[model samples]
Target: MDTCKNCGKPLENPDQELCPACRAVENAKARTRREEKAGHARRRRMNRTTRKMLIAVCVLAVVFTGLCVTATVMYDKYNPDEFIASVDAALEAGDARALKNLLKGEDLTVSDEGAAALCRAFTDAAQREALRGQLEDQVVDGGAQGAFPALGVEKESVFFGYSRYSLTVHSVRLLLSSPVQNLRLSLDGVPRTGEQTADGILYQNLFPGLYTCTVTGTTAAGQAVEGDATDLALLSSVEPTVFSGALPIADITVSGCVNDGAVITVDGAAVEQKPVNGVVTLPQVAVGSTIGMQYTAPWGAVTTASVQFADKTVTTLAFENPVTEGGVPAAGELNTLLTAHYAAYLDALNNQDTALISGCTEEYKAALAQGVVSDTHKANLYVMGTAECNPAAIKSTAADGTARVSCYVKLTYTHSDRESHEETPATAYRVYTFTWADGWKVSASADSTEEAYNTASMDALP
Candidate 1:
């Protein structure tokens, strides 16, 4: 007997490769493979047709895209709005060459001079940032307004019902005086415009209000000239403001112990300052007017002072910190108080007043009671002469205006049992920490450190 090759079924004929049941299964598998091969050929034909259609569609799409880009470039070249937008993009990017390409007219040629002008127009980082902000807003809203005038683009519209107005300012020279040049004008405490001629300065489209105009310039001999014609009113278009002035400003110096980041306001307007170093000197104060000032300290304390012009041209002002609320005296006043306190302290020591000695530092009191000033030791000690203590110097003050006062004390002392009437003259340097609460008092620290003299123990000596 023989077996089928696939299923191991017995066959009657030993020469057969498979039994009848296995042979039928092999025939079905062969037919299925043939059908599959036909189906794959049909799919390949369909795929080839689809790929050709896709390639044709892609080619048309690319052509359409190129046509659209070309149309846009042509439109932008002819359209004024699009042209101005191109110029703005160039200026915003600080591309002088691109801006020169866009700036072309019969009167304006793309030359070295034209390129230099364009560069200067967009060289200012602040002005470029302003233009970029304007461009971004226009792009977002699809609106056309606030065009770049330096590129010869006019604003499309101006919003009405606003407080916009115009004013012309000029400097006048007296008969014997030379002309002023490069005069810069500040409006409402901000630098607005600069005009070189003495004819007048024009500020157009400004909000109508009472603006403080300060003019500054240098004379022919390079002498500085500055003055303020403040509070010039611009009521309406019909009643426009025209301000003129001669530069005879009174130089005023403002100095004080204001906090590092403090702000100074003059005549109720906060002046624009860049990193003030605690003192602000105003070179353009108007004469014949009382100047009201307010200082804002870094710790949120505010104090105000006024300067009267009737006094003198050059004036100095020292501002006091209102945070302490008059509890802390000024520096000079504090020095005087410290000197008096040192004298009183010395007098107490000379008279051997234990009460005053106890009123000093806690460390001083402890040292006095345990050491030389003990009751057991007091009887043996004798002060052969008077004690003299004088405040020699006041050190740098703390943030709260407290300071350490150094004093030099002279004293002569001896023991009562000594046979000779000779005295010991001793000189000691003492430092007293002075702080303010309701009044100035000597601050105390431990006496273990030898940083300052132990005044309490010394005072206890006879």
Candidate 2:
């Protein structure tokens, strides 16, 4: 085993049975493993290349999509401007279809400035209508008289001013009307205005120091036109003082929330409210007047609405129904009277009004004093089918020397659906105390919760 006994041949034992031939085979096997490793590495590199190509294609797709979106947004923004230009071209060329297409997107806004401007621009309704379409389609952008606000004028001026020579020379920026339409001349603090004319010359012969004048007349289609007061002295000129008028104030009010036993006052006048989100509504405010209001909440917590102003020219007092132990005053009274009250309330709801239930003398007096009913208010009482007030439980005594009675009257209010736009059939409790002459007045009661009150309407029930 250790050496070749004859011819120097290498010897192998039983455990090492292979010869040189077998050794060569083992070497070839090692070569095969190396070749397989190289092939695996090549495949890995190929896979990486494939992944990069996929990524590149996706990036290109994203870029293409982004460009498409940008193009769409640009198209929408410019379409309206393009339409306006087309309308102008059609007017010049007498192309009816082009004008008709442009008119389709109009949203009508009948401004006085627009009416005046139209009158100036066109001779008849057809011409005016076409321009009206233009005005309606106009936008606030596009430089005042552009697009949505299309009362276009290039130059506008108002000739007036203080002493020396009160006057203003208007350097128009976005004015678009040709010679401008609907010329109006209003002088501030002055009793009279200059004659109406397309030519912007106002002549006032009054002795002048320095005075502010506002020439406000609108264009024909009704766009507002202002002429800056140019100071005109008989022999000199001063810069005109400018003043801007605000829309008139019509009404204003103050309101707040409260618990029990809190009083509300408006400008020192006592206003009444029931506990639970108490709101005080003021009546008869002049348009354009900035109103001041102060509210004292429960426990002396207070809120004051700042100089609140309105512009709609007229304002009136609006009262939300006083919250009662039975929520609203109407639904709390008689269970037996529910059918009658329900019908009356239903009729009122149908007509968009409130129903008045009780008409008894004592209750009437209480209602009147409490401001529940007034002479100007039309009363709609509930007609009783079978419902009755337990007269025995409620006894009246006089008050203010009229004699009286005071007792707790439980008023359970309920409301149900469409037949009942308000007043859900759900029961709420109220305490009613009657005095001899005052009939039934609220003494002590549970909070007429308004949280679920909006849901109490008959219109909401099944």
Candidate 3:
């Protein structure tokens, strides 16, 4: 038997190296060594795993700390109160460049002058407070509000779940109308040339605020005039603000009279010493001055009602030949002819008697006769009206001795159908041309396009 090298144990048989008791003790020692070795290996592996877990936890802690720090810094940067404070500081210092930088919008272009005007608008303490309140309200309510309202609040960017806000601004437009020509308009010392439109001139991209509006222009008579409207506020962004200038002078045209004896008068005083032509130009008449015409006949003097000079560039003054005590017989003769002709025309239409129509030209009579014959088979059409010439309308005589007269005819009559009778009131403005061949007889007649006739009331007609 072989003996144990270190323990010296006895063998149990011939091939054994040690005795039984000694062998048992040696086996126990060997088992103890093996168990100790295995325990050491387990301790080493556990040490390695613990080290790895500690390293991972350290990395995670560092990363979380960094993220929290970055989040805090971003929150500070985008703080709404701080942002509002910066804007208030710029406003207090009247720093236009700073304010311009703070303002943001789409397609927003602000000039140096416009920015300066904006700064001036909010220089007052009350205005600044109001603006600050609007900004704060936007933050709280998430909408725009207040008198001096902003366009809206905008979210510019986000960082770490933090959002940045920006206040937006918009430019206003102004619509201006002026009777003065070559108009020069300025707002707060900024010159503006507006585009011409159908309604008026349009000045675009103006800053909204209280401004001193200055306007200058050249009158039709080459007169220089200027006007100023202070504290003209343009705050709305929806519609174009309108401004009008009160000019000093206006251009006037006198018409409706061909009589060489008629005199043009202004404010009850004669403007022209000599007789005025049929159509005369009274340049640079003072605004608010009443213009009229005076015609002194052999019997009495007649003056047309005066009209005031206002914003109109060109005004027409109609000369009237009202019925005086013993004035011209042309008006009376025309009235008599129209009264009889109207009666005869109605009789011819209702009774089918074409011969009743007189005081008309031969062609007109023939036309009436044809119409009466054609309408005989239709419903009974009755016509009755009062024919009165406008007293303030034109009564001009051509060089060929033909006279033109405009009159307003009001018709109130009844017509009968097969079932019912209806009475209708109608109005007609007609121009009658008279010739002196046989007498003052109407040679032609048509609808009047005269503006004076259309505007004249029944009380003004005779």
Tens-digit lDDT string for candidate 1 (1-462): 498888888888999989999899899999999999999999999988799898999999999999888767655545445644665577567665776564443222354443444455455567656655554555434444433422222223323311211111112111112245566777656776533334465554443223456777763334455764655544233322455544664556666634445455554555554225656665555444344445443322354555554434456655544332223234455445545544444444445565555334555545443343335543443443443433333332335433333333343344453455455554334444554433455554222222333333433212
Full-model lDDT, candidate 1 = 0.48
Residue 311 of model 2: what lDDT? Answer: 43
What stretches of model 3 exceed 4 Å from their correct place?
1-57, 140-146, 209-212, 219-222, 229-231, 245-462
Q: Regarding TM-score, does 1 or 3 come out ahead?
A: 3
lDDT of each: 0.48, 0.37, 0.66
* Per-model C-alpha RMSD: 29.3, 37.3, 23.9
Models ranked on lDDT? 3, 1, 2
Q: Assess every candidate by TM-score.
A: 0.25, 0.18, 0.43
lDDT of 2 by residue, 327-400 (tens): 11233343433344344543443344433433234434343343334333233322223332333344333222
Who wins the lDDT comparison?
3
In the range 196-271, model 3's lDDT, one tens digit per residue, is 9987889887766567888878654445777746557675677888887555666677665545566767666676
Model 3 score (lDDT): 0.66
Model 3 steric clash pairs = 2-17, 9-18, 10-18, 10-19, 11-16, 11-17, 11-18, 11-19
Model 1 collision count = 3
